[model samples]
Target: MRVDAFDFELPQELIALRPAVPRDAARMLHVKGGVIEDRMVLELPDLLDEHDVLVFNDTRVIPAQLEGRRGEAKVGVTLHKREGLRQWWAFVRNAKRVRDGDTVEFGGGVEATALRRGDDGAVLFEFLGDEPVELLLERAGTMPLPPYIASKRGTDERDREDYQTMFAKEDGAVAAPTASLHFTDRLVEAIDAKGIGRETLTLHVGAGTFLPVKADDTADHKMHSEWGRIDAATAERLNAAREKGGRLIAVGTTALRLIESAADEDGVIQPFEGDTDIFITPGYRFRAVGGLMTNFHLPKSTLFMLVSALMGLDTMKAAYAHAIAERYRFYSYGDSSLLIP
Candidate 1:
């Protein structure tokens, strides 16, 4: 399909710069079987049944945005993936000034040598120290905010808490699973009281999620891989939930993608650990995930394509049109949507 088919005009003002205060106060658009309903995130517990299970991505966002100097030229680095104990794949700004083997010195005693460049333009970097990479980032890196928001306002102390979800535990992700950001302790308690089951998995969201689809056609676009894991116990529980006639409601696209990657042709989920470059597009049949709760996405983005695949293209276009007309916020810090096909 043509990538332009997923394009839509979004007013500049609609992009959200900050998450809604109280988080759960954010509006949610419920799109069920082509029907649209306006609701609030706090009402999510009432939206599903006792038998339904909500799967969450527990991958914590690390401070992956770094600014450094390679000799006289300034370079920006956003670590996207972990390659080893001290090696990472990063998207380097001002790549023209640096070469393979060149060392970039980030402040606070953090430094890394460029190993090589990938076909996707990301540079492989190995940190030049014995200390844990997480510690190095703590001293030098800031929260990796989505460019849409960061381009408008600088990242601050507020983002250190606001950008992370209450479920964040495992540290690896460069990006937060925005859908989970709307969740709060109060909301979780309400969900638990309603008997909605909850589960967790890990998917270290990479900076590639922010990359645009420059391809003319969907087939021409390539998705960068992101590491994810689903243990055998979790897989068994998820499969059993479905077998007992319960729906698996993925809390975000990260969980949805990981679960789908783990599901078989028969839709039974299995234990999985490794990278997933699952590119969901229209005409692709979903396997395990029954519903998805996610934030609004960019125009012509892979996320939009995934949502379009979940609901039909025409249905998603109409749903997005409704969202825009209703003035719901957009992007990572934007409003939420519950998609049930």
Candidate 2:
């Protein structure tokens, strides 16, 4: 399908800047068997069967955004993915002036050696730090908010808690598991009380998630790789749930993608850890995931295409039209949708 097939009008005002006062108070759009229903996030448990399985991406969002100085010039660095032991693919502001081989130094004993310039003009850097990179980020890094969010003096403390999920365990993602943002401890308990099963897997959401589909033909677009893992423990539980007439419901596109990527032709999930660049488009046969809970995405983005794969192109187009008309929230800090195939 053409990349334009997923395109829709999204008003700027509809883009959410802050999370709902009570997380679970956000709206939810439920799509099942090509039928769509308007609902609330708190009402999720009522929509599914008691034995259904819900899978979540437990990758923690790191404060990967940093500010560094090139001599007297200030530059912003947002790490997309770890390249090597110390090297990372970082989006550098004012990188045009740094040139190759220039060094950028940050506050609090943080520094990086610029390795090379990428096709998108992003810089490859080898960071200098005795402690773990995660520690460095804790002290000096900023939250990697989306491009749409306007920065103030810098990333604030609220992003530290708001951008992260309650179930976040593994540390790797630059972006948050947006759908999981709507889930609170109380919400989890409510779902569990309904007898629904839950499982956790890790898929470090790379900056690739925000990358738009540049190719006119969606089929030619190449997806960036991100590290994901489904351990034997999680796999066993998930497979058992599938056998019990339970729907394997994914909490976000990241988890859904990894589940589909890790499953075989017979729909058996296996242990997986490492990079995955699996891209799903229309007509692709899904293997494992039976349903999905995900945030509304940017227009013409790979995420919107992923939604088209979960539902149909026609259904998504109609749903998005209604969302735009009704002014439902959009993007990372937005509302969510529950899609069933």
Point to the candidate with the largest TM-score: 1
Report the Cα lDDT for residue 249, model 1. 98
The collision pairs in model 1 are none
Candidate of highest lDDT = 1
Which digits, one per residue and each the tens of the lDDT, describe model 2 over residues 237-306? 8999999889999999999999999999999999998899999988888898899999898888888888
lDDT of 2 at 143: 87
Cα deviation at 7, candidate 2, in Å, is: 0.9
lDDT of 1 by residue, 71-94 (tens): 999999999999999999999999
Residue 7, candidate 1: how far off, in angstroms?
0.4
The parts of candidate 2 lying over 4 Å away from their true place are 118-120, 151-154
Provide the TM-score for each candidate, comma-separated. 0.99, 0.96
